[model samples]
Target: MLIDMSVTPLSADDRQRYARHLALAEIGEAGQQRLAASSALIIGAGGLGSPAALYLAAAGVGRIGLVDYDSVEASNLQRQVLFTHDDIGAGKAEVARARLLALNPRLAVDAHAVRLGPSNALDIFRRYDVVLDGTDRLAVRYLVNDACVLAGKPLVSCAIHRFEGQAMTYIPGRGPCYRCLHPLAGDALVPSCAEAGVLGVLPGVMGTLQATEAMKVLLGVGEPLLGRLLVYDALAMSFQQFSFQRRANCAVCGDNPTITRLEDDGEATMIEEWTPEELAQQLEGARAGSLLLVDVREPHEWAAGRVPGSVHIPLGTLAARATEIPPDRTPVFICAVGGRSMAACRYFAGGGRPAINLAGGVTGWSAVHGPLPRPEGCQS
Candidate 1:
């Protein structure tokens, strides 16, 4: 990407616009110019991508691409700072593209309002100087990393779960790819932001780091996070680093690779929760008699309210007290909304219990059928 440095001659307006960057001795005019010439692709224009795209565009990254097939939901406004309330129901990629261009008219923004899959990942990745993994899904993480490896593009990946987040860079042979760092399908077991919840500002912190790393990779400035993980704990207000190495058998980046081409991992596909109405209908059927309604929310939540006839067994203790759930009755896991219960469902399904996830959980249940009456032994 050295060509980015001399892609275009800086005009007088460019000097005025990037005066701050020009003032930085390290990233003076030439580096800023390189930034103005470089291109980046940010997968998933939500959470991490929100801040990264804004900062990168603000920093004058010359060309930018956004890939996301999702539409803006009202719930997205909490953290996906890229879209406003008015933008809800709009395509995320299109809205993000318009916003980014509005933020920096000089740079060009490409909106791929489509999902990134095996067919398009490599083609799109090949055009960018670097790829930023802002997507939340683990399967996509593997897809992005593998595509980057095959395309020989540098990758900057970040993820936020609840109040904590982590980031790393994969520069092919320079260090471990994502698969090496997280060598297994452990992420399938991890809860998503929808399931675990997140601090509204956490992704901002992590995404900014991604933008910073992208500049470093392009400008060849400071040491990038090539062979290490940057971990951040918001509650503790601390940052930690853990080092890792490229695995000899990374499956995709290893010496004897098995994943030369991208393919869908069935386990990586997230299970869709049943609708609130659908769950209600299921609960009404005679089958509900044979179903065990187990509440997996925290004790405080359980004490506050629960679906009538539901048994309380907090998620943390469920693994240890598994036998408490009756095998005779098909277990139907429920939580505040649906995330924890979905995780529980996955866990049980993996164990061959094959339980059902109460789509919206108690909260969703209440939304569709009004507040539940507090049981005799419960306190709000």
Candidate 2:
């Protein structure tokens, strides 16, 4: 995905603004012009997008597109540094576009305030030379990767969870795409930052790396993360690289690719859910005994705090200890957030038993009702 480096003469303001970039021999005048000519489409305006978008805009990526459907939630401020408290309730993409334009007025910022689905992914992707996938949603991650492959655009993909972050690059005919690494779309059961919690600086680090990779690919100078997974641990302050080859049977970028066109990647099996407010009312009523709250978080998380009357059953051992869950009572699954509990619901559904997920999990309950009451008892 070589950007057409038709040298665009930089204006006086551009040269003065990118004076530091002009000093680098690798970048100098030509690379700065290349960046000014290149375009990048960022597929999320959350934590990763915040830093990536800011850097690209400051570095003079002439054209930038932001695609995000979510609005600013108070939770986003912890990592999504693109917005301030004043920007809450506003569309993320729109806010990001405004911030980028403020950083570099020369940038052509396109704010697509919509979800990137299969129907429009290719169309939007065709307009950019490089794609940056900063989305935490697994299904959307795969979609972005596949769309880049199909649209013949290079993609810089990065994700952060807790204190750890991972980044990789995929170029058409260059190396493996994301699907080659995680082959199953159903693997969306993995916890996101919302469920697992992340260090505030984690995305800042990874997103900056993503921006760097996109610039490298755009400049066609340094080695992009192609064919390699770069993993960073903020806690340990360590970086590790794992090399992977393009899988021969990859459904998208393989020798005989099955995915001829972009289609929505089926998410994990949907399960019955109970909102925090709904579950709270149920617990206060006579139905409390008839419904059981099963906490599926780890032992450490269990010790932190738990809903009153909830029974602890760590997710890893749920299968082996299924008998402990009374069949007479309808089991309601819970975790730190809702992700692991959803997996628990899926497990029960597979065995022909009806189960309910605690939407947003214990965190949601705490958020709605202040804090969880002390657990009555711990059951394993």
Candidate 3:
């Protein structure tokens, strides 16, 4: 993933603007020149992209492409620093370009205000030296990985969920790919930041790490995070590293690669079928008022501001007492946050029962409705 170096030297103002970068022994004049030649395509203009794009632009990556069709919302401002309150309701890609150019007008910023699909991925990818995956969805993660593999480019991937963040760089033939780590994940649609709440500052940490890795890869300066998976727990203030290797049978990068291109027919399982906003919308509608609110948590948990009329059925006893559940009422399963409730929903839904997981569960519910009221005699 070597960028074509620019023969054109930095202007006087450019040198002044990047004096700190020029002062660095490792990333001085030569490294800055290489950065000015490199191109990076960031595939999501949200959490991870916000910081990464800013750093790349500030560092003077010649061409920065942002691909996203989503519009900015008030919710995005929690972690998407590139967008201010004024930028809300504007297209994320276009708005990101404006912010980046404002930071470094010399660099070229391409805004693809269109969805990243199989049809256009390879064509767009070929124009960049490296691809950064800022997207949170598993299916798209797979698509981006495969696209990078085919287009012969390196991918820096970072993801944040709840209090945890993970990052790894996938250099073609250099180390294990994303598929080598999680084979079955591509066939599923994991919850987005919208459904699963993230700590406001978590992506900021991970995205900066991604920017660091991207710079390292482009500059060939230090050891890149190619084979090592870095994990950060913000709550615990801890970072852990694990080693992984390329699989011999990886579907895209294997000896006899099976997947030549992206296919459209695969069924992706939704990690969260219902979000808090969606549930509220459904409740406001006609039919779901009779829906059963099943609280699948421990007694102590249920005593702590559980949904008022939810049927109490602890997860451990759910299987034994499955028959006791009223079949007529469509069950809206819930737990502390979302993990346990989604598991319960999947189990019940597998049996052909009408079951939906309360995304973010009670924590999500409490965010909207405040502290939920406990059952009449359950707690003071």
Candidate 4:
């Protein structure tokens, strides 16, 4: 369906502001009008949602609904570019709504300072034309997918870890749902942002991609990421696309669907709970030669201030270099904060290796051992 860009009815001010868009053959007046008529719901306000929200607002998306229950923190300032230090302790959705409106007052921005769950997802999503999943929790991802399917909405989902990110789109009845690619299991362990440690800029790249996909879906131009996984490697500066097919046995969107109704997998909770003191003792043991410390933080982080004598194998390189780690040693994993290290611990534990997570990670290590020297090129 080719839209007539020149024929879009726009106010004088809107036409002047979106002149660049009007110049594009792919997205002219008709595409801009389509954007003006669409509504989208973004399900998180962290890293991914930050960029996605900013772009959607700037692109003149008619109505945007933001759903988040978190408050801004100092740590979030590193990647959530939409907020400032002053916004800390403020509700992310509310603050984001204010910032987005400031960028484009003509756009309608709705802020819902509540957590999205099975009970509320369908109703919230039904009001929008597209749904974007920017959440980091697994249970929420599943809930968003199910809700989108139930509402017959297209879902644009993205996830980031360290320097890697992945995104896919789920269009009900037209393409595979998230469950088709990742079949859920009772014992399957899902990594949380608090336990996976994502790079600050990683989400920016992936989130922008998601925004691009959403724009394409809205304008009905270009191919959406349906049935395809877009993987990004920031360190190597590479992008890889993999194709997937709908699973007939998918429990949710399958032919004989088992999950016809939305159900909660329980409330969302941060993974890995350990105090600073407990984490210190674990690191001390590793330094005492009784245990091996595997610093899963990036190479630069290891050089900054790692446990006295720890092996530096970045988490992204783990799968390929797993053989380098001796199976005989009891591994104690560490990362910038604690997220990535805990994920590393789980990965090793599942592989039959006795692995322990260093709570609070290098951040906690620095508090106990004094501030260590920053590596040459390592950014704080």
Candidate 5:
């Protein structure tokens, strides 16, 4: 067993409560007892944490810690299955604690109704055998992974975006850490679920997989996702596995590692921004001829509606079509929201071109000027 089986002997009630687990040959009495002795710390009591918490609690995990500072909102009812209409406006961690206790009164649930920061992450992580990273924020993801490496604890990290999601496991000295796989300095340029959108049932599927991996890690019964990434697509209803390797120069878990302490990952470099009102004022001023309005949204979005004098340069094709942009005029990038445009701005700025991002993209512009003008043949 992964954990010490010398834990308190299972009572008649535990045997009855986990009768199903006890029946499985892989997770018989000893495995169930191991589960009963193990503890898990789950960050973010939102969509991913909801199902994982429920299953781990019902499966007899002795202790579970939930970390989140936000309160439940009405929109959370769609994917955050741990809360209900009555739970709206309630603290997420506390509500999740109550729900887990109600599911299984034997286990202990710790509700950390505060944000997880570098100062407190290591201390909180040391108490748990494993960590489940359910947070959607990019910086927090790196913090959890790095802290686990420093604390020598196993981490089960999962992320969902739109219709797809990915899960991976990291064990100290066994495999690559999150930084080894994603060497990028920051991931904030990637839009969040709210900035984009997600299928209501997506996190449910991924979080359950997270619970499955956590139990396996506790039981030491099956091969964990160590060195492997599991990607799931709800639209295609398929799963794919990609293998990764430990980097020799990885900053967190490498032979000559540089990062020996916990710190927040640096955010994307700040670029110049222009509000919709500023763009309008510039269009009517003498500098109107000196600006090149570049719409970096997808072709579909561009076809629907766009600014009158803007040029369509999809983000995916922008890098290759750099020559198309005029050298004399300043380029102002715009997208559906600001994320893709920000990325475009950074790209041009890296090439020594002074670029600007529309603060809120087409949505912001439309909000200011009533509605954007559409193409003659556009369907939307």
Candidate 6:
């Protein structure tokens, strides 16, 4: 698909604005022109989308769409850098659109403050050339992927944990879908940014990569991440790429195509909440050996009075140490306040492992079980 860059001559403003891009050998005038004609829809306005949107707007993408149902919270400021304390309590998509437009008034930014689900995904995505999945939930990730496949649009997906991140691009026939790599969501608890905690700069790295891939696809300049997965370890400061093949039996994009329609995963809804009383019951069950409790909190948190006999495996380590979890027992996950455990539960449940959430988490556990005992040399 050779782009006719000469058709749309750069305006004086664009030439001055993208002077740096015109200087690059790989992305000269033609690439910049292509970018100016591209349209992209980003699905999250939080951490990943924040950077991705910012970079894309600055790069002169012609049209950008933002979708998010959440409101900015004080907690989101840690990594959702696009929002400010003043923006807290405001809709994420609304705030993001205002900010991006202020940064580049020439670009078109459409902000939709509604949740993107199967009902609206196709209609919302059909308007854009590429869809970027910045959402952190497993079910939503699958929804975005399948929708992209069904819409025949490309998807640039990225996920982040505490110190690690992963990214891949799905170009329908040209590459493998997300299911091809993670065929089954593994039993290991997938830590979330909220539960496992993330360095403020981590999403900046991964989200920027998502933005880069989107721009590359738009400009048709570099090889997109088709059929490849990029994994990054901040602690080790290393990046690795692996080849992934599409699964012939994939339920959605597979040869048989059994899933012609979208079905919401009920487990995703169950993992999102935990009442105080429910949390207490789960903790009691853990104490009596009625349930196998898995603590995916930090080591220091465990040392500071974890449920007795509960095994500690920080969420970041859960993926690499899946064998450590005993398959004979029904696992119940616990995090500081339940968010991370929910993410972990979703990953496990999606992988065919039935796990329960320890509502209220350890914070609630300590309240009912009495103040947690502070381990020696451990700061409470």
Off by over 4 Å in 3: 185-195, 264-380
**Residue 338's lDDT in candidate 1:** 72
Tens-digit lDDT track of model 2 for 263-308: 5333222345677899988888997888888998887677778987
Give candidate 5's error at residue 105 in angstroms: 0.4
Which 10-residue window of candidate 1 scores lowest in summed lDDT?
264-273
> Per-prediction TM-score, please?
0.75, 0.78, 0.72, 0.70, 0.73, 0.73
lDDT of 1 by residue, 1-61 (tens): 4344556788998898889999999899888888888999999999999999999999999
Ranking by TM-score, best first? 2, 1, 6, 5, 3, 4
Q: What lDDT is reached at residue 118 by model 4?
A: 64
Better of 2 and 5 by TM-score: 2
Model 2 quality (TM-score): 0.78
Between candidates 4 and 5, the lDDT winner: 5
What are the Cα lDDT values of the candidates? 0.82, 0.85, 0.81, 0.78, 0.84, 0.79
Which residue pairs overlap in candidate 2's backbone?
Answer: none
| Residue-level lDDT for 57 in candidate 3 | 93
Tally clashes: model 4: 4
CA lDDT of 42 in candidate 4?
A: 94
- lDDT, candidate 6, 131-249, per-residue tens: 89988765678778878878888899998878889999988688788877776445234444355478788999999999999988887768998889999999999999999888899
User: Which regions of candidate 6 are displaced past 4 Å?
Assistant: 1-8, 185-194, 264-380
Global Cα RMSD, each model: 5.0, 5.1, 5.7, 8.6, 6.8, 6.6
Global local distance difference test of model 5 = 0.84
Backbone N/Cα/C clashes per model: 0, 0, 0, 4, 0, 0
Worst 10 residues of 4 by lDDT: 264-273
Number of the top TM-score candidate: 2
Candidate 3, residues 1-380, lDDT tens digits: the string is 55786547888998998899999999998888888888999989989999999998988888999999878978789999999999988999999999999998888999999877777889999999889998865446877998998888999988888899999998988988888877643223232323457898998999999998988888888988887999999999999999998888988888878777765313223223566778878777886766777888778778877865688888777778878877777778788776666656656654657577786688878877788887777646
| Stretches > 4 Å off in candidate 4 | 1-8, 190-196, 264-380
